[model samples]
Target chain A: MTNTEFIKSLSEKTGMTAEQLEPMVAQFIGAFARELASGRVVSVQGFGNFESREKAERKMYNPTTKSYKIIPKKVTLNFKMSATLKDKINS
Target chain B: MSDKVTLQSVAESFSRACGVPKKVAEQLARAFFDTVVDGLSNDESVKIDGLGTFRVVEVASRESINVTNGERIVIAGYKKVNFIPEDGLLVSNLVSDMPDVREDVVADDEETDVSNDTDETDIEETSEVDDETEDVSEDITTSEDEEPIDAVEAEVNMVEVPEKVEVQEDEFSGIDMLICTPESVEEIRLELEQARADAERKLIAAKEAHREVLRLEALLDKMEKSMVPECAEEEQTPETEAEPVPAMVAESVAKENLTIYEDIPSVAKEESAVETADEGQKAEEVAQTPVEPVEESLETVETPSVVETAEDENVTVNLEATTEEPSSEQEESTDVAPAEEDTKSAAEEAVQSTDAEVKQEDVTAEGAEENKDAQAEALNRLLSDKSAATPEPVRKKKDDGHYWIWILTPILVILIFGVSVVMYKAHSDKEKTELKQLPVEPKNHATPVKKQAPVVKPKVETDSIQSNTNVPAETTATEPAKSKAADNKSTAKPKTYILQRDETLTKVSRKFYGTKDSVRAIIRANKFKDPDNVPYGTEVILP
Candidate 1:
């Protein structure tokens, strides 16, 4: 779903209006990204837990140059749908 | 805990919160992407209490990591986990309400749980005490929940039960009972103390019981050892100490024992073997003949000696007894047979000797049958005496003789036979060698040489005639020619010599009408040119 559609669904499920859920949904996404950037785990009750683990910076060879270079560690964000929320969407 | 991430962004927030790189965040996110993987890896269940839940599924291996590199790696392969949401979570204003969905679906299956999860904190503290107590009562078969505290509870129950009348089946009946008053608690405490003392006493008693069993077993083994030798001593004592009684009994039984003297050869061989064995020796040539006659006499002489020797003859009986390690009953029977045989031989020997004496007296007219009996008695007596003597000095003498006989006889026989064989072989060998060297081929060769001589004889005759004429001296023409013709005739004829009469050299020339000097001429004519060394008493060819 698009971000706006997801927010609208969340507003409908919690019986809150779209206007009220827009900021909450944005804050949730922002908070998730910031936590992911710092490499910490997030646990949600009635859903699942998320944890980050170290991945060593590797020497990845540049194919064209035929020489190796360090691939610096970078952060990536992720999303997981809860079983309760998935059931809600399916129903 | 305060601001936990929502389900949608939990994986994203974990990586951001931990400040790991995007690749690592993606990996962490992927795990949350699979909710089953996340719960299982963390060893936690995502239990939405009112909803159907996600659980940390147990598998053979939960996760794997590269130990060297410290990288979190998925344990490649499959594991079992799933999610089930409750009806409440699935429906609200945004979703349809399905009536078939359960109101509560979050209940865990404790019925299947094998044990309460023993948190790490409790294990180290209690395990030592439990293990020590458990080892001693290994047969009690208590499970995890029924651990060592049961013993303490058992002690507590002992106190509240009525004294002396409390039966063993009711041993743990009063456990967890309450006391109503201070006075009652005091009484129960006193009882508990007494119960503790009684338990100590019973433990001591059980130990004593085990020790007693051990002592009784040792005593039984000692008694068996002591009794065995005593029984053997009892069996042996009567045989030796009261021999006369058995002997008298043997005499009464003599009529029943007649077979012993019948087998003398076997008995003699046995005696011979025994003697040889004692000396560890061979057959002495002198002893061989004597051994037979002595064995024969053994039957006719002392009764006991015959009996003893006969006993030796049936060596198989005793040897079989030893080898089979016969049962007591079988051994008893085997021994009985030998004893009976010995008695009979002794009696027979005695009878033979006495019978001989009676015969010499010519008692044939009176009771001649009684004579035989009397001789048997005498022979028996003699046999007994000989047997007694033979075992000692006679055995030594016989043994010595036996050694030399057995050792030397075959060797001497071999030596004599060998010498004869060698002489025969040498004679044959010599005959063969002589035959090989004899003049077998020369006989055929010598005839050929003799035959060749005839071919050369005519040439020899012409040459001899010419030599005589050239050698002639003071001969008239006719005389010389006549002499030449005579020499030719003599050479043509086979050369033979003839003895002349007593004319000697002087007379021969005169008588023949030639001078003594002509004797030389005659000798030349006859080819007796060496006239001074001519063979004596022979003259030839006056010409």
Candidate 2:
């Protein structure tokens, strides 16, 4: 299911308008983006952990060109399911 | 995990934004769904830029089954919405707390050491693999010591030696050579083990075959050892048996010769003079002599069947021989001529003896001769018709006795008497025929001659007996019955005729009767000894 589909499904379930639910979801997305960009963690309880990291410049292959290209050293987002969450998923 | 954000949960969160009632909010959500579906159907991209892009992607047509109707339907290439998450949203950290493993390679020409950072688990695995390989190599070396791998090792080297291996395929198999390296040490060990097993099996079979060969040789040796003594005994027995058989045959031949000599002394004497009769004489002398037990032992040595045939044939033949005539007559006739005086004396003696007991002895003698002739005929039938198997002259003497002497005695008597009667009738006829031919009348002498006939018969028989033994050259060359018949013919006549030169008895008779029809009668009337031999002017009787 997509984000809009998910939101629309929630609207049908609750007695709320799509406009009010839309702002709350946007605010949370914006906060998560800002904190991760500043090299901070957005730790959500009872869900999963997400973090940003940097990778060393390394050689990678572009399968379309079948040639080696340099993937530049850049920041990347990393998420790890917490032990409790991992246990819950496994269970 | 939190409650699943279904359409109901999301709509509750969205209801306050649209300021609509729950039912109106549900309608608005359905509208947004329709808008997304419509946009995708038009092949539009609904991009929520920071979150992700939802693009209408065309899926190529493929065959699929409609489960409800079980009908095959082709899902034509149609647009469907697909979402691609933003790069920032994709998690990059899957493994947590991974220690920094990179080594600093700041300067060139520096020895880099990352051993400290190497995984201990990987180290344990390498050591374990090395240990297993060492044990396996030890196993392979043991197998190599056990089996000579020359045949297969060359093939293995052939597979591995070439860097660019060119495989040679055999028509019989797809696998050329299984090249085992340190990487495949276990397989090499297993193959060596199999080879060792095959070698051991062959060795065992060869050993078994060798044992079988040894066993067969031993059996052959045993058989040869057993046969040696039996072969020696068999060889010796043939020699012993061969020696005795000839000795027995020689003894039988000598004994048989002795019997032959005893039967005829004249042959014994002549055989001595003419050939090797010394042996015959010795044999006869042996049988006749009472000095030695050689004859007795010979009798003992001869089988009972041989003795029976010899004694039976010998005694019966001699008894049937008409011993009235002495054996000297046979000997003298067969070989040397005895003196006339001796023959005359022998004949006189035989006649006197026959006359004294002729009637009784003749019957017995003829009866015995008949019996012997019957016996001889039986013997002839018993023998397959070989002239050699025929009994000797001594035996045949008995046969002539049956045909001529024994059978013809009574017949001759009856014939003589019947002739007298016929002669009486013939004389009557001759009177008429004679009267017709008679130039002179016949004197009546018939009754007077008839009165003299009985007396004349014996005297005539006596005369012939005397003449029979009275052979001018050899007195013993006599046929008794034949001579008697001739004498009877001569005695039956009254008149005589003189034969001219070269005349037969038939011619002599013809001179008296005018026709030769009376030739036989005339011949019968006179005892012209040989009818063909009427010597010139010889006296012939006319009946």
Q: Top model by TM-score, which number?
A: 1
**DockQ score, prediction 2:** 0.01
lDDT of 2 by residue, B164-272 (tens): 1211211111111112123224434554554455444434433433443344344334433543453344223221111122222222343232233233333332322
Please give the fraction of native interface contacts (Cα pairs under 8 Å between A and B) kept by each candidate.
0.09, 0.01
TM-score of chain B of 1: 0.18
Model 2 chain B weakest lDDT span, ten residues long? B100-109
> How well does candidate 1 score on lDDT at residue B502?
34
TM-scores for all predictions: 0.17, 0.16
Which ten residues in a row are the worst by lDDT in model 1 chain A? A25-34
Please give the DockQ score of every candidate, comma-separated: 0.04, 0.01
Best by the lDDT measure: 2
Predicted chain A of candidate 2: TM-score:
0.68
lDDT, candidate 1, equals: 0.38
